[model samples]
Target: MKKPIYRTKDEELAQIFSSKVLPRLRRLEFFGIIMAAIVLLVVILGVLALTVFRFKVPDIKLRAVTIDNYSNLSGTLTRFNLTLREEIVLKNQNFGEFKYDKSEAILSYGGKTIGEEEISSGCIELTYTKLVVVLIEPKFEGLGSNQNLGGGTNSGILTFNSYIKLSGKVNLMMISIKKRTREMNCTLKISLVRQAIQDYYCH
Candidate 1:
């Protein structure tokens, strides 16, 4: 009779694996995966906190404030076709509180106030000029800067000057972490620049 080549229990079995019958994960790989997950979670949370619980200002809000009903304007200009109309857009962009009282807009060219418009908003309009551009072929007695934009250059002479004063209620994050736009009187005086020129040789 042939004896089976069977090993006895006392001889012991090949230790396939230890523990609860499940494949054990390597310590280094497990720790690496855990750390990666933790870092991802932390980054996501940080981004959320900044986006939801702080002062967030928009790029620019072009709200029409002029008496005219138009928002955008475009036209070609010349002697016979020398007329252009435009509506102003005021931009409000800021993280700090707005000082809408001291802000204003003044137009000038060659050291002269050919036209002037005032802006007394209660906040920031840094993205746009307070005095929206007004294009025209004005009757100038001497050869100088008409200092008006939006005329589309019908051939002659033109230049533009502008000053923006942002002042008003500063938008802020409330205690509940909600963004609020509130008006507060502040002083923001943008300087008046008038060193522009335009000479078309319109002999």
Candidate 2:
């Protein structure tokens, strides 16, 4: 039989490191580093997308308000009647179209509901503004003792506070995403003699 060859300690150690330990450590380092970089990149992109390219809510405002008709009892002005017309505009400043559901415009006086009108469902194109008109007719039985009436004078001037509420949703690409609502309080001055709105301010 041939003589058996025995390896020295240093040679055995080198062989073990090259064949087993070195390969395992290399594999771990390569995969671990690549995975960490991938995770970091994903997080950065997610944050940028949420903050910089996020969707924005549309702007709604009352463009114009008018009193179409007004009538009251001749001398005492006890019974009050009036028709109000409002023009609302919705401005969409996003990159996608803004679709809204059917909504209502509610009118209130002295914390009491007076009238309500329906706002039709529609969509506003990207970077566009849409106008919606609403008409409300409210009848008052006895305004003679209402403390909320401001300018009750002999010249037939009357003042009151009115509230309007608008509620709807926003849709993107035919998918519902967010809900939107707005409330406006307005002070109105009316002239019973001329059947017109004298002054108004809304907030």
Best TM-score among the predictions, by candidate number: 2
| Regions more than 4 Å wrong, model 2 | 1-52, 72-76, 142-155
Error of 1 at 29 (Å): 22
Backbone clashes under 3 angstroms, per model: 13, 0
lDDT of 1 by residue, 1-203 (tens): 99888766654443333453324546657889999999999998898667533444333222222122212122323221122222344444443443345333444444454444454444443333343443333233332432232242333334534434433344444222223332211111111121123221110
lDDT of candidate 2 over 91-159, digit per residue (tens): 876656777777777666555666778888888887899988889986453344433454564567766
Per-prediction TM-score to the true structure, in the order listed: 0.32, 0.61
Q: Which portions of model 1 miss their true places by more than 4 Å? A: 1-45, 48-86, 91-99, 123-156, 173-203
